[model samples]
Target: MAVARLGTVVLDCPDPLALAAFYAEIIGGKAEETEEGWVELTGHEGTPLAFQKSPGYVPPRWPAEDGSQQFHLDLTVEDLDAAETRVLALGAKAVDAGDPVRTWRVYTDIAGHPFCLCAC
Candidate 1:
């Protein structure tokens, strides 16, 4: 048997360009086109961020309050306040995630996939 390592996390989006822009700005990179509905950002250091178009894309409803949170991204951070502030400014929604918020806050991306910022 051979060992393996972590790769990229791909989240479907409505518009690759637009979603790429949101991620590029938030992560500090540039999106390079591959096709009509596909683009990639190549400055992520370890792995490239990729986006694909889904015309029928419907943002995740998040929480039973609206719909439901199907999945989420957990990001490790050094400072909770700083990370939350930055993501919040960048349009991430802050919902009640009490226990998790003690060390991290769960926020939704522009597409509504929940992501967590925690002490790294």
Candidate 2:
């Protein structure tokens, strides 16, 4: 038997509710405010994502030494082009990694957390 199972991935941001809502919309879930500065997205078709407020939160500067991204999420999609359009409309900033033919593309969320949309 396994010693443990994955629960939720919590992200620190300036606004918990907003971050929770953003992930909820992308991942198919409902955002619930448990308390001030805390929110949870549950019932997603995938894993649950939670958000916690950090007053001094500094968005990670991807591709840079200072405040570099700690981690990222890779989401598989059937249609990369379509997904990219939608994500961009939802405030995702595409990262110019200069590998157009790759199976995955990187983007940063509103709070500057790096994530990827993968075709594989």
Q: Residue 89 in model 2: shift from native, Å?
A: 0.4
Reference-based lDDT, residue 70, model 1: 72
lDDT of 2 by residue, 1-120 (tens): 999999888899998988887877777788899888889888877777889999999887777776557798988888888888888988999985347677888899999998999996
Per-model lDDT: 0.74, 0.85
Q: State residue 17's C-alpha deviation in candidate 1, in Å.
A: 2.1
lDDT of 1: 0.74
Each candidate structure's TM-score, on Cα atoms with residue i matched to residue i, is: 0.77, 0.89
Question: Model 1, stretches more than 4 Å misplaced?
Answer: 2-7, 64-68, 97-101
Q: Where in model 2 is the C-alpha error above 4 Å?
A: 66-68
Task: Give a tens-digit lDDT track for model 1, residues 22-62.
Answer: 77766668888888888888776646678888888877765
**Superposition TM-score, candidate 2 onto the true structure:** 0.89
Q: Which candidate number maximizes TM-score?
A: 2
